[model samples]
Target: MAGATLLPLATAGATAQGTATLTDIAGRQVRARLPARRIVLGDGPLAYVVALLRPDDPFTPIVGWGDNFRSADLGGYLAYRQRFPTIDRIPTFRGSNVGAIDIELAISLEPDVVVLNLSSRAAAESSGLVARLARAGVPLAYVDFRTRMFENTRRSIEIMGEVLGEPVRAQSFLQFRQRQIDRVMAPLRDLGHRPSVMVERAAGLYDDCCLSYGDGNFGELVRAAGGDNLGSHWLHGTFGTLHSEQVIAADPEVILVTGADWRLYSPTGDWVNLGPGADPSEGHARLRRLMQRPAYRTLAAVRRGRVHAIWHPFYDNPYYFVALQKVAKWLHPERFATLDPDATFRELHARFLPVAYQPGYWLSLNTDS
Candidate 1:
């Protein structure tokens, strides 16, 4: 990390009154003062707060964080870097949500509040990271964008808003999120029968068969979008590996593969380059290749040209409403024939994000090459 000025959390916390007690997603009580000026975000997913609350200047209050975005979502990092060229100055800890966290180093940064994901709370506590932070007098705020998101995402957003001194903005964003969701779900309420959709998490990020979300993240998104997630029936946890044989057995009606331009991480990998300023022709080519896999050829989705690829990062962020629209569009094209997910995404960027809008976030096999 590049241009940063470290300050003591004690001084920042002293500026406010008594500590505010809030219940985290893990149902644990977190005590922290209001308007935390110095923050250390646990994983890259918490970056959603920065984009939503402080989009104009996200790096200002951020003292340190897990540098997952730079590695997992390079396009998003590049966009932030373009605007705040000095973001690299902020100190960062190694690892994402599931990785081993450096608690001692995080406390050394002296952040008044440390925001983590509820899904990773067990790992953090098992490693004694939480106790160390608590001993150092650094309050931890646990938020979640996955795992029962429909019921908890708003609470997570509101908690961040309250801690960051933007309660109004947080509530407004929740309203906006609900509206986006209603736009897709309202019409599908009276409809019966949902397409069995399979979510391929981080497609091509590995060398083996495939990984996917079971009951969380993209699995939840597919359900919300009026589709039956195959993972929900077979797997028991948030994520798990699905063998090619398992996929062939399920024969999902819609195969939705999550991908991104991870060429920097895997130059010759089969991942699709789908993000801002992405090329449709290139995405089509990559997705077509995935469809040609032996097991995929035997799947119903591929035979009917219903296979699709979408942005991978949507699995970790609060921008899932956008994913919902995209999923709905793919699961039932007839009902959503006039729906424009790209237009909705552009509206979100224009209203909330500092960056300009771009396409290629998602596409279907049937789309013109």
Candidate 2:
């Protein structure tokens, strides 16, 4: 909130001309053309937020975007494509990271504004893409939903709303997001116990032992859901790896592995492919296989059937509040017995998304719960 500000228009004439001075989440002041007619997304998953702001035509303003979405959330991409086939026509760069962006192609698109994630600020500046875009008379804005999720999610949504000229819609979505999160947090104090949780980041996506969240992203979500995050005690950053031995030593009460439809990224890997329309039986079998890893085979969580898998994309998107509700229920079943994450997601799709809802975002080893 500190750096996200929309300055008053210079005059009615400028307002009529469709331009406004605004500050991005990175504290950079950019003068973006109002309701950006031509917008390039630095990360493709950003479309998830944009769709919430412009449910009718999320891709109309997007002339180009990064390629991460297709590979990272193939199920989600396919869902949108099924509804809006024209999405395939949008130009996409090689990678989601700023380093992999084709700067010349982005500038050649003649975009009114280029929106990148806050994590890309350093790369954008160091690589001189920011300066180059500035010289091209294009504005570059940064929005973050990953690195510092809770601190910047609202501000990022506000910035996107201003960029899209849908301030009212953005506020409505934000209020809805808050109400959902409050469902989990407001009743947390009344709960008697906080389970020790280890969130395996992209579990089985790689052949390595483990990757995990430390103090941000899903790590923050775990704490909000009334669980003590084990990774935070060892790793200092948002993401890092934990030795299999460390995982065994921690012996967490709950083991939540973040997974997705990673077949595109890891064709033969053992990742739990959990996403829109994913097969729950297949996902459950894969999750059980992951538990067989040396790091988890003897854990109390696995033995007690407290192991679960959740969609990995929630760590980076605005829909994380839904993940929070689901996790709260998993950690404290009796206390959050009636809280329904599936219904919450269904409402989100019905209210804001252009596509219909699908129910393959999560899976659990203990089906009885």
Candidate 3:
């Protein structure tokens, strides 16, 4: 289609004009002038998005995280940060309650636009958070990341950049991220090896549960890392428990445990004693010891020292680049010996992340005293 043409007006005190248009998902052509600064991010990837944008984008004058403290994914993020320094510290961004945001708070912020993560429309409608924000004349745009598709990781970063007027930065970041993932996955493509793996979550208290990842998430990470997931076919949530029988039946080629106690489990409750936390060999020994337990001893991975602990930082946040690097290298030593993933992770965490990277994190398949 030809571009829309503009006609000059004869009226006095008139400014020059150009035709500009944008079409929303509903096919509605929104013909309007450009937006001004002052934006509010409803919840979800807002902080991450804000961080990716160059420091000078005035558009996101004010950002909000919304009431997402209840989400399981968010919980995973919090858990890691609470225990490990490598997981980037989550920045503070305000929002309304799960039911509705406090209007007065948002009004004081006075944003021009609002972006939302409408994963559960029901949650939004029930609380009226979206409706009230809309009533305030804040335009809301929803972008899905958690579920709509796994690829939305890059998409979310791009959308945040678009709104913040830092498309170049976002593009560069994405390219860097993709290349890192490719490097991690490339070595595994040709190898006919798969480590039957299991991921367990910290249930706050009580015994930990067996968490499984499917084709969508870190399971993809595991596949790229060159290991078969034992609990994967059993069909579990991203953070869920599996029957002991289920774990034994799969007979994993490798077991990757995640918990604050992982590299450093103890009868007493202290985490620092675990390996240097950055030393892969120390962590490796820790995992090796855990595999020797009577029940785990039957597993082939335990018998052959195939288990290792990849410190569970970078579970979320932009630090995903670091997590993938460590996980891929941990899974495929022969293929990625030159990668030096830990050093790369340390640097990325030091540069892009808000927190400092700690050492002796990723461990072997054994337990340490």
Candidate 1 lDDT tens digits, 1-369: 121221112232234545688877767788886677788888865776677765655677788888787777777777778878887887777767544667777888888788888888888888888888888899988888877778788899988876776666677778888999999988898989999988888777777766888878889889889999988888899899888888888888999998876766788888887777778888888888887776587787888898888988887678888889988988887998988888888777766776777787888887931
Q: Over the full model, what C-alpha lDDT does candidate 1 score relative to the true structure? A: 0.79
* lDDT to native, each model: 0.79, 0.87, 0.50
RMSD of 3: 10.0
Inter-residue clash pairs, candidate 2: none
Tens digits of lDDT, candidate 3, 170-210: 67667767877787767766787565676543312134335
Q: How close is candidate 3 to the true structure, as a TM-score?
A: 0.65
By lDDT, the best candidate is: 2
Angstrom error at residue 52, model 3? 3.4
Task: lDDT winner between 2 and 3, please give it.
Answer: 2
Arranged by lDDT, best first: 2, 1, 3
Model 2 scores worst on lDDT over the 10 consecutive residues at 1-10
The residue ranges of model 3 lying beyond 4 angstroms of the native Cα positions read 1-46, 55-63, 66-108, 115-122, 143-145, 148-150, 203-208, 236-240, 260-305, 309-313, 347-361, 365-369
What TM-score do all the candidates reach, one by one? 0.92, 0.94, 0.65
Q: Candidate 3's C-alpha lDDT?
A: 0.50
